[model samples]
Target chain A: MRTILSVLLGVIAVTTAPPALAALNVFACEPEWGALVTELGGDKVSVYVATTGRQDPHQIQARPSLIAQARKADLTVCTGAELEIGWMPMVERSAANARIQPGAPGAFEAASHVRLLEIPARLDRAEGDIHASGNPHIQTDPRNILTVAKPLSDKLAELDPANAAYYDNRHADFVHRWTQALQRWQAEAAPLKGVPVAVQHKSWVYFFDWTGLREIVALEPKPGIPPSSGYLAQVLEQVRREPVKMVIRAAYEDPRPSEFLSEQAKIPAVELPFTVGGTDGAGDLFSLYDDTLHRLLEALGHDSSKP
Target chain B: MNTTRFVIAACAAIGALSCPGTGFAASDQELKEIQQQIQALKSEYEEKIKSLEARLEAAEQAARAAEAKAAAAQTGVAAATPPPAPPPPAQPVAPAAAGAFNPAISAVLLGTFGQFSRNPDKARIPGFELGPDAGAGERGFSLNESEVDLAANIDQALYGSLVIALQPDNTVNVEEGYLQTTSLPWGFTVKAGRFFSGIGYLNEQHIHAWDFVDAPLPYRALLNTQYGDDGGQVRWLAPTDWFLEFGGEAFRGDAFPAANGPGHGKGAGSLFVHSGGDIGESSSWLAGLSYLQTRAGDRVTGADVFSGRDHIGIASLVYKWAPQGNPTQRNLILTGEFFHGLEEGTFDGNRFDQWRDGWYLQGVYQFMPRWRIGFRHDELDSDRLAGVFAGGTLDNLGHVPRRNTALLEFDTSEFARFRLQYTRDDADLTTDDEVLLTYNVTYGPHGAHRF
Candidate 1:
């Protein structure tokens, strides 16, 4: 009888304890932002990522879990150049969290910090799912990540002022490490300058600008349209004349188009980790860039171990 | 000798004084000409400086006017077109400030060519009466109903969505129009307006998203195609690891099954609970239970009126499997729902109680990225009433109804689909076979459907 009473008292103590309030809840729309939030917030925040590495960020199905997470978030981060236009608005409306509403201090967008590429000179639906704001795949280049980190950390501090010092220190440390990594990458990737390549989509324009890899042609007929047989033939003809070394594609994209081009043009198809967790080695922001360079260098028949 | 020397000195002194006076006159004239040239150069430079200052002032005024015009144009664009919020610190496209009210508009066109083994005039259930608009379309080349949808955020705390369906006979129906609260506290949302009831799984989905060309036998018999009425609803989502939801609705109950009366007060109400979660890396499942109850005052079916209480209960389960978490390439879905209803009422001056039940099971498999095949089976059972009822059609009372359907569909793109379906319906003594080929296309911005 005494033991039973003791067990009952123990259960009451466990159930009545208050939940940890020090941890801020964060909702990230993609895996890259999720990794960034974790890197900065550490144990001071709990994060929920809405999409996996394999899923396309352009469209997502409406789920109750997403709404539930959004409702509880203190800060919501996303690549907001219309990348999530298909469902983000609806999710925001459903979650009804005033803190994470547009224009709120808790709402952060990474694309706003970086200089967006591929701004269409004209707007037309015939362009095939073109974003009016610009290209939203900004996480491919590490330089853009460094640019976004400063503002995102400030946003976190604004939302949770108690953790301002923590965010500031972490952001400063990240910037320092990131600058050194950028220098190392530039030195190692000197050989890739002026190397002509073909891409499956326009997602790699920023990455190309960083590495000095020349994009000779694209496999996609338009922005999002798959190439027709006639279009593929034209690309093949262009590739034969220009003689590109490799065909590049994101790991999430279908490999069939790249493979078809590779077979016809007799070039290698190299799949790059477009964001964090895109490949096995790309577990964080640092490894994401490391793996991307390693694959690109390996495709060029150069030893990545030396770099 | 002294007198001659003095005369020579005086002549030499006069010659020296006259020569000095002539040189001074020549130097004074040259100095006056040089002073005139210097005055002309100073006046020219002063005139140039005055004109340059006027040009500079004009250019500055023009620049200020241009800036103001650009600001007005920015506001005009914001008011005219509902632009999405601009990213921070970028002045390229000024994000709509507070008044961005652009609503998403979409339209869906559904067309079908159906071939029936027999005349559609004989398509009737034994002991059931069809509604006014329940008949299938005319034999060949008939236009099906098309839908136009408009949705927008009403304000910071509310959202509005409307769908209007255009019928083949040049009539328009407001299928659904509702305003729902978005930012309710404690995971609660309230919706007010006309909407489909939160009944079984497939009831809330539009026909364009249906697996088959038409609703199953159970849905048609129990809910008259789909149960929608002017109503108010409240839904709550649980804060849990898995997906859990509870909802309740109060409707006017003016549509079929319920009598047309003053649609105020608690005419009809329903309660439902649903839960779903992933089973493993590649599989997921959802299950739900719902209950609805209403009082029918002078409800007319065929010729008789049912005045009493009606209750319905539904249970549904769905399981989906996709290999390696990629549903685009291949997936399989198995879903089923069972409905049971009880009606106690006075039929043609005679008191009668009846019980009815129906169920359907369907499975769809996508063999490839863009191709899929599906099969569905429906079965229904009803309790036969004894004694003759006045002004009613109850000829074959004890027959069980069933149907079998098979479909093959191809999705050309995300916005276009083509399907061919064959159904063997055995609702009457004489079975009917229907073969329908359908094409569905969507235009504009369409939101992603619920999973």
Candidate 2:
């Protein structure tokens, strides 16, 4: 019993010991939020991302590693609106960290900063997985990123007051560069305006809204449901009548459905990096949009090098 | 041109009339004088108009130069300085409706159809006493322990959950009801109220979350399927990159394995430690060690009664693998547990002391989306009893009981599943072959799946 007690005490001492560096620890639920925090916080914050860009944010399991990371976090950044309703709550409950609880200064939810799209008028299970708080895929729109950056930077400053000016300056730099990038993209993607397209999932509402693209048909019969062959056939029939320019899907989505639609319609199939680090070209927030626009332009037979 | 000619003739006539009744030659001379005078006057006025136009042009040029200078200064300022940083907009989105703070309530419905090669009513594991919750389903169609769960954040600092099980026999059981600290500092949490003890790895997991249709043989025999009691628990998680947790529980001892009539004073206690970490991006593992100590006073099961002190030790390991750390498509899970129990004191008025052991290994593989196949093997052995304790529940009967089970499962979505399971058992008095078809569905708020 004495040995057991001594060992436990040793573990407590080791675990509770403060680190040499006084950086604020941030736990980001998804890779996009992680990249955004890094862009704003720079060297003042240490970040742990719970899921990769290739993983579905909505379907992540509450892995133990996530809980361990959350236990040490000073702030938690996530896209709320129930996108992570399945697991983030469990991680927060198990972490036992007072600093990152909901309604605390250290908790930053990006969805609250901007108007969300596609709030369900009616709630029903038969409609497939739906978020009552609206579509949580707000990161698809670059304008929403700008909107979230201010509050997230404020949150960082709130948590680590010593680095407040640093975060503020970084946030200003990001906004300047992001605004210029948005302008350049608008000019480069002029030909894509009002282009008709097909999508495998409804995750690209914000993306379509940003680029002025028209959604012709979705391969999935409903949100979050994998497409059935019969449903795909109906979509193909619709595409035959409408003749969309291409079929688009996120980098993380399964390719089979969109590939089939592309084959049947004889249109180009475009895979876009939906978030930061989703593809090799999408190494940061800027390149994420750059690569996405590049793929969409390339599908339209425009020389990507010119843009 | 005509109008100009008419105006010149009219001016000449007017000049002629001014010299009334004069000669034609005299009129011509007078017109010449008048024209000369008009020419001189026109020249003076034209010169003045020219001077005036020059002054006006100078003023316009000066105004244009000043405007050009101002425009250049504005462009220069814009180039030299960046725009001022804009403040984050006030939340343009109205916060989502502050709906009533209602708990997330969900229900799981489980229905099963069972077929047995032998009479399930006569089922009994040799040398073991089964709890009321043990054994497989009786014959044909039956509703399993369907559950209704309610969970919510009580406040900023506390969380609470309740789960009630509805048995097919029209009995309602409180499977779990607990309040837990959410804002505790230093990776510590406190839980109070009736709860499943945090001993073995699988004990705390609800039945609806179980990977299989039923518990393993060791769990059934040693833990009475699952052990829950009125208790308070404290768990401390290590602040490390690796997942490490230590927890202990003190129970009121009115539940299974503890039997009845312990008269309070913490009739049972358990301590457990678990550690886990990821291996690269494709795999992760968790391992744990747990110990439980309790007293059983006049515990009775099917004419076999005992009064004794019980001690149980368990070691469990679970490893999961997915391609690129994504489990949506294909994945594999390998899990196993070892249990050892020691009992002392009197059994049916005989001095009884014995130690027994059991273990099981299970693996489930998801070959494709929504499809899975799994297999498990369970075995138990004991120290043989003799003399007065012979033929009793503790008697080994010179047999090492074992069982093997296989199952195939399909998930239509995250909220629904269908499974077909088959088992060959020798743990009971007579070897039995069991086959079961079950469907499980959950609706309302989705539940979290813990790894």
Candidate 3:
């Protein structure tokens, strides 16, 4: 009996070697945030991504499965610049989890930390369609990702205090690689030197600034307006006259206008990854830059190494 | 290859123009640079058109254009459906996922079951429900679903779902039809193909989309025979969250139960107005009124006797509130509506009064996270006229039918439901006792967000 008890005790100690730690259940509304969580948490947290990166976050339908994911999540992070206003309210209700209620610590609206652009002169629900507060595409700006990293690491620590230092160290390592990559991107974009571009929608502002590309014209006469034939013709006329290098847009935007212009005028259209994993070729965060910058350079025919 | 030839010609021209002092090494680099630029341009076109084109509607158009350059690029859908249904057994989706494009399409498809019988009153199939359960039903599946739902994001801003039902016969049916959109500027949206009208909350929703699995009887009466409007609609939301919608649709081309006209007259148009957004922390409401008119195009209604069309108006008040903090998570809904329809417009010159009124008070209480119980009381004051077969007067067979129902539902999940209902039907046409027991289940992927 003594021999058996001692052996069992040894096995129990071995199994219980790791300190009892509360499991982290995190919900990321978009795939980019999910990737970030994966990079930072490693094995310390469990993550659920509400929408795939390929999907436009603004137009998600509140499906029951998504709500279920929300229900079980301990922390819910959304790219909330009112980007998900159409469906997030419904997703939140469907999840039936009261812990991650908006304005609650368990819920993080990532856009809150970043500076917003295109602030409407007058804000009202009556103004057709409007983002009541901010534009939520901050993930495209890697700097914002770095800025939010501190908070994410801190939140993870609060949830699992035992691994606080480990989370901090990971954030530091991410900063190093992320900065290095950004420097290279900035240098490569130099030839893009104030090259004029036309954007189909307002999604590419941060990316345009980061790359030093100037947006000479926008297709939409008004925000969110579906391009009319007249508008397409007008844009073609403008491009034929101006010094525009390429027409840019996010993935999932309508391609009809781009094609019409590309055919009518010879300006090539460039579709960039709006979020990480927006394309299979652009899998993770770092590689996403490689894909985007490469596409831009290729559109301008600036990649001198290719044969 | 043509571009390659152009590059070679340009290189030769450059060599002839260059000064003898310029080195061959510099000229060689320039030629190589031109070649590289051409290749880069080619790659950019290829990547945008083939790989990421599916992401943008415009990119898709460009991709289709690019596809023409390659004989193998048959269609814009890609050379091969990139994400093939991952080898069946390990696939996450049901093999027979009804409709491929939209959950709304499948919602109508899976929820509907119909029959053509010599006797219009009774059903040839014993297993399915035909009439009086959902409203004006005649020997067909109610297609009115009470369910659990799931949906996954397809591309940015677009979602897909499947609805599963719970009820007698334990059948499944589609509740939503075709495309649905919530992202639009200036608070506007568009829906195309077969989908429920946005006249009232109940009419726009599936039984599974409701807090109570069974819809109130009046909603059924008003929307009977016309749950889904097959054309398209445009909705505009005002700054005050007030919504104005103008919609028109063609009727289902069902062979039997034909329309009142000869050539495809079965189409409808509607005008709706309402406001959205929460009223406060504890309550929210959607108040609206709508008018719907349908011309009997599908029917070959007896020409001289019943050749005309129909019109209906719905005024609804939907109030939602919670005694606790969460309104939808736990709440009470009080809804009331009055509907009126006119028939025999083409057959008879005279216009008679055809009015039906329905009202309900319902409440849902969540006892736990995944489980909840809902109860409702509904009564409809109906005046449905059944004309004489041979020939009839305005006074013949016109009776006021009053029905009251008590329904109990258990929500297994917000998107899935199991319901049991008993109704007491008293009508001028019948004096007999009527008792009914009904069960229904429904669900959609992320079905919680349709409202």
Q: What is the i-RMS of every prediction?
A: 8.0, 3.9, 20.7
Docking class of 1: acceptable
- lDDT per residue (tens digit) for residues A148-267 in model 1: 888888887887888899999999998788888886776667688899999988888878778889999989877766676799899999998889999998877778889999998888
Residue A295, candidate 3: how far off, in angstroms? Answer: 0.5
Which regions of candidate 2 deviate over 4 angstroms?
A: A1-22, A305-307, B1-99, B264-266
Interface RMSD in angstroms for candidate 1: 8.0
Model 2 error, position A15 (Å): 7.0
Model 2 scores a C-alpha lDDT of: 0.85
What DockQ, between 0 and 1, does each candidate earn? Answer: 0.26, 0.26, 0.04
Whose TM-score is greatest here? Answer: 2
Residue pairs clashing, model 1: none
User: lDDT (CA) for every model shown?
Assistant: 0.78, 0.85, 0.57
Order by lDDT, highest first: 2, 1, 3
Kindly give the stretch of ten consecutive residues in candidate 1 chain A with the minimal lDDT sum: A12-21
Cα-based lDDT at residue B240, candidate 3:
23
